[model samples]
Target chain A: MAAVDHDRAAQVGAQPLDVKAIRSDFPILDVEVNGRRLVYLDSASSSQKPRQVLDAMTRYYETTHANVHRGVYAIAEEATRQFEEARAKLARLVNARSAREIVFTKNVTEAINLVAHSWGRRNLTAGDAVLLTEMEHHANLVPWLMLAEERGIELRYIRLTADGQLDLSDLDRLVDGVKLVGVTCMSNVLGTINPVAELAEAAHSAGALFLADAAQYVPHLATDIQQLGCDFLGFTGHKMLGPTGIGCLWAREDLLEEMPPFLGGGEMISDVRLDGFLPADVPWKFEAGTPPIAEAIGLGAAVDYLTGLGMDAVRRHEVELTSYALCKLAADHPDLVIYGPADPASRGGVISLALGDIHAHDLSQVLDTAGVCVRAGHHCAKPLMRHLGVTATARASFYVYNDESDVDALSEALAEARKFFG
Target chain B: MPGLEDLYREIILDHYRNPRNRGELECPPAHRYEGFNPLCGDEIVLYLDVRDEKVVDLKIAGQGCSISQSSASMMSSAVKGKTLDEARALLRAFKAMMSIHEARLDAEDRELGANGQGADGEEAPPMGDLEALQGVVKFPVRIKCATLAWNTLAQGLDGANGSAGPS
Candidate 1:
């Protein structure tokens, strides 16, 4: 199961990941920029796609390209089979109960908006509440805000502790009237790996539904919806070495069945009468119009590639690398202020840093000149930035393909940038 | 290395470390406007006090990167006592210099010398210390940081003119 217990994996003593072979699979690592080898540390923004995923997409377009589900011809049947097979792959990766529970959208943002519109609009009323956290990305926050504005619902927030973890001391009071609790399984900016199971339990005890934004979590960790026990999970493919324009939203079968269709269009409809129309079945009801067919197949190939390497090994590698980075950065750059948990075990590989008196923009530019790509901005979480008392920070995230050498390059670049600025 | 040195010249850092013409001018008479670089969240507020068609005073207040803050500081000094038309001309010259062509700028710098005066006494370059920002053209992303103040000043000048023709 993707969401297998972490304690179990730790007990077994996870093996070191083979990053040398993994780097061979991603051709972009070979490119040079600004007379230096590309040291891509911006995986949190988007991971580079591997050859397997790219080949799958190209193969689909080259041979098996057709409009799925509608045509009964040979090529059409093949296309539909490939598309549904990809859905099943995703379901397996996330330990979803069935492929029918998965709704494909443009990206995680659209998936969240789908749930907010289809379920939130139907279930929520004035004076009802939606509970979110301070660390949620704009994708998770804005949709619920829009719904609240239109439906006159109240919105509550779970605050963050000084150390960047969620402060849940007041959870019982905050969840009193909340109809739904939407939160990120991992903080994209802070790199805090939230306890999704605990949150789900809290939401369930309060008689509320829980939606986990797994955009950052699913890529770096093994995820199982059943074990996590969340009612809804949304994640994007691009952040996990798959192509862009494809994302997944998994919901419990019964909840999806009861929800109204999100968009009125060709694929999501069973019958169209001038007076009224019949919506399609559970997953298709949310998937409107022609979908990203090739991209979906690419995502399936990405799942296969990740599964081949094993998610447990991947997580172990990231944890080890993150620990190394935290130590290396702190020892070398004492003046740098790092955001998020001090203990690497409580976070993913994402690390956001505020260097002494230097703007994140300038730091990123200096890093770029040395071919070290790092993201420097609000990271789409302006509220979190405000909470941290800073406008922006330089973030360098790692992935399965990244090793300690990458961290060394990042540290070296930071030293160079500091000297250059001074 | 040479490119970096050109972009972060000592004078620009001096202005960034010690800005000039910063703070508020008594308004109701002083026209003010604000601008922001949405890409990087850089902001600038420009203040212009015009008396008899000339910019009698200029001030800036904002926080941003070295490029933006230093550019604003230099811009305030450059246009403090110029006429509205001359200030707009300086803005145009600054923007033109910030545009592409790094090699040409280097050549222009060598040909015109440090004083920015042509050997043949044609016309002095409009931008003074603001010319140090010409190296910003190398970085496509930082161009907005260098131009936030000028754009705000332009808007302030427009407001000042529209109200009572520089009262």
Candidate 2:
């Protein structure tokens, strides 16, 4: 199969990326969906776990089923080692300076909230503004909106260009008065990949903190927090072919030290007092409760799996798949109208479309009937939908496991539906 | 054996292709109702040209799936020339039939089943022309797809959010 440039996968000012063998790692692609062979294309929402990841979790629960950091028992020690090992894996995945900078949360949503509650509360003044984007997922958007309102800070959005790319013209304008710049690395709806490094540089130049919602980007790309120069990066394990209930936030060492702890508990406090109690250092201070130990272990396995396949390879595969999907959807289904960047060279692997006169929900049903699983709705980007002049879009987001044949099945099913309706 | 295919039979396809009563009421004083199914985001704009509480003509104009478009076409033809009370009763009957799939409709029993056209074959509820929508039951996700228009009609007659233009 010929590999071509994907719209979102084309990284400006970045090195060459690879893809292909990564698809072999995920075993769920061999299964069936709706009584037909599965083509898991919804990786933008959540990715399917590989056999290695699943086995790692099962091995943890089966062989080393014990609590971490507290138990004096041998199994407890093993659990603690494995848990820390997962942290080490995550730290390495993002090239963090230390594992201590990684605080495990439930998902990226919780991680963002941790920043908003503690960092925003500490840094924001009454008139300070937080710069965001209109294309941000609710997880990335709502937290800042709420925190801004509560702290008397104004929330400003950087609009997207007509082609769905970030409108960089207002970068200085929006970054000027803003104290924080929170943007998505990749859009779930439009598949527009933001240039995180450039945005981070702009944020720092303006003396504003930059945070990346790496949920949609991290799984496919090799992420380096130090290289990107981002102040903070948040992502979930589930979206990266790992277990749910495990997420991570990597904050700069100095930022983590300066910001107040998100939650205080036994693990997060070294000493307590009646009037004054000092919180423990960086990661511990943010993680207050018994985290998802098994999930963290599974995430370690997932990182290992992705690393084995290589992030470059994953990105390349997705680029090829998205490009193929765009061409197939256009050529095969003439009635279909794909949203976002017209060329696959401009967007992520997410293929969002409206098929003729069919409502997105109805199209989703018809596709489901033919065992083509896709997501249809406002996709949590309601404001973006209003901007796009459509109610909802049928999205088929590809990952490592999907291939050209999956796009064929999707195209065939869509054609069947259009013919049936017509 | 009349199956799901029969629901999407030639007649239903004909109605879907060339929908009847599909326009705005011309120079008329009548209430218009619009309904939307947010789950799938299907919208139906139903115009009721009423004369002294009687629906002299009912018009619907919108684009949606076959279920929605067909239902809109069905609703238009079903309610035309019917009194407000009769229309409401018919709507209530259709709603009941939609919710309770097993219980046969009195409408069907009075129309063809009792009139000696069909017997042993249980009469699928004649939800006016909406009987074609029975295939929607198999696809539970699309049940709302078929009911978008009827739900709007229900909201309008109940006197709520209607007569306003769609945002």
Candidate 3:
């Protein structure tokens, strides 16, 4: 896969990403930890929210705080509009044909579970397979595994290559009896950005529905459901600089309409006559009970913020920083084993490193004292860790707010950790 | 003080670099159990040999962070050649040091003097080299890493009391 060349894209129509100005938008970046300036490098776990997103949620709570659909009052109607408008904004962000196709859930985990339990249980039968890559997070893998166990279907895995990319050499055989092709758009560990459109095409040609776990991809890159041609794209709001407890599952409207409600409760039903209940419309049918109203509004604002900054600029900044980090880290620590593509062009800003004889937790702890926040674990992808022949790696993921200085802090902290551990 | 230097004490690092009694014990008269932190994928497989209600031999084998591996190493040395009851007491003392359940530090304060010193009071027993892990208390998250081997050994002792398979 070729590097995206997002720098060119940013230069074309978008203003150059001003990281210093962007840093000001996130207040938490100013915090101090262990008497050291905070250098947050854990965006893959969750991105920090900007004041725009925070203010939007607070404003919604302060002014318009009422339940939707059932209440016919003025505030209720206002709340309903804001909530639906949030859906429209999210739909627009992903280029979904209709807002009705977007289903709000707790997080990407729930979104994937919604599709697996609601659509999967109904459509898939015994002997059918859900093809997944080895690099899938537990959020994408466990839900499908549960479905496979209950429905008596096969769960096949696509092998990973030596360089940490998905080895699609046996695509024909792997997709033979597979009903669903579930894969991550980008590896949280390896930082390998996958060819989502190409994979979706392969799934379609093999008569399987493609579900791309865009939890990692949607935050760092520009997402277009139409361009990707995926049947379903699951992403969390928190990873995109919005609050937790909100995520979007964008599926084809017809598919959502055909699928039954995942959870049976209020707002999801149109008429309940003691014996049987009629489900609500497409997206609402999936979102049962009290929805994450404020969270959705906040997510809408987050989408707006990203749009204002331009995703191409965000990507360009990340690519430049990642390239610099790769070079800087390589030059500084010759013994350090950084995973994923050596070329920052081939990967996102996530850099997973294994220093010689130094445990990731130790590195993380040492770095923590230096006020460098990094993820030091299997990153919810144990199989991928095993594939990489490592117990864990200290992961540093970049976002819109992260700058070159943050990477320098991480590097310096890593050096300190190495020396201290030795 | 709750410092990184205190947490990664020289004694802890020594044990981590050269873990004591790290290998598999023969199956006969040996009870093996595995412990996993799961959060960081730190695993410890404890092999215990009990004879006449005493742990005559013990070995720890697995891969993990320095804290876990060092704790396991220290645990093997701390418990080896001790009666099951004595080992349990040491385990209790270690857990108390970690203040597992957020228990009052009064008891730990009495045991560990102001600056990683030994007990001044008679009621609190000095935890010795285990006192090096007193710094681990500041890092609540790494407490699990420091306790994996001891917990696994505890489970293995229970298995010995119940099944004692192939003995």
Expressed as tens digits, the lDDT of each residue in A1-422 for candidate 2 is 00123223334423333324455556766677667777666777788888899999999999998878889999999999999999999999989999988989999899999999999889887889899898988898888878767777898899988988889996878799678899888889988878888888899999899999999878877777877888889999998899999999999889999999888777888788998788887788888978789999999999998887677666766776787788777888777788777666445788788987676766776677567888988888877887898877889988767778889989998887787776
Task: Name the runs in model 2 displaced over 4 angstroms.
Answer: A1-27, A148-152, A263-280, A342-346, B1-38, B41-126, B146-167
- Write down the worst ten-residue block by lDDT for model 3 chain A: A1-10
**Residue by residue across B59-97, what tens digits does model 1's lDDT show?**
898778889999999998888899877776676567557
Write candidate 2's Cα lDDT for B109-161 as tens digits.
55545433233334333455566666656655556766677777876666522
Clashes of 3: 0
* Structural similarity to truth (TM-score) of each candidate: 0.92, 0.80, 0.94
i-RMSD of all predictions: 2.1, 4.4, 1.3
Assign candidate 2 its CAPRI class: acceptable
Tell me the chain A TM-score of model 2: 0.93
| Fnat of candidate 3 | 0.89
lDDT ranking of the models: 1, 3, 2
For each candidate, what is the lDDT?
0.87, 0.77, 0.87
Query: What order do candidates take by DockQ, descending?
Result: 3, 1, 2
TM-scores for chain A over all candidates: 0.98, 0.93, 0.97
Backbone clashes in model 2, listed as residue pairs = A7-A344, A7-A345, A7-A346, A7-A347, A8-A347, A18-A312, A18-A313, A19-A313, A41-A397
A10-60: candidate 1 lDDT, tens digit per residue: 337667778998999999999998889999999999999999999999999
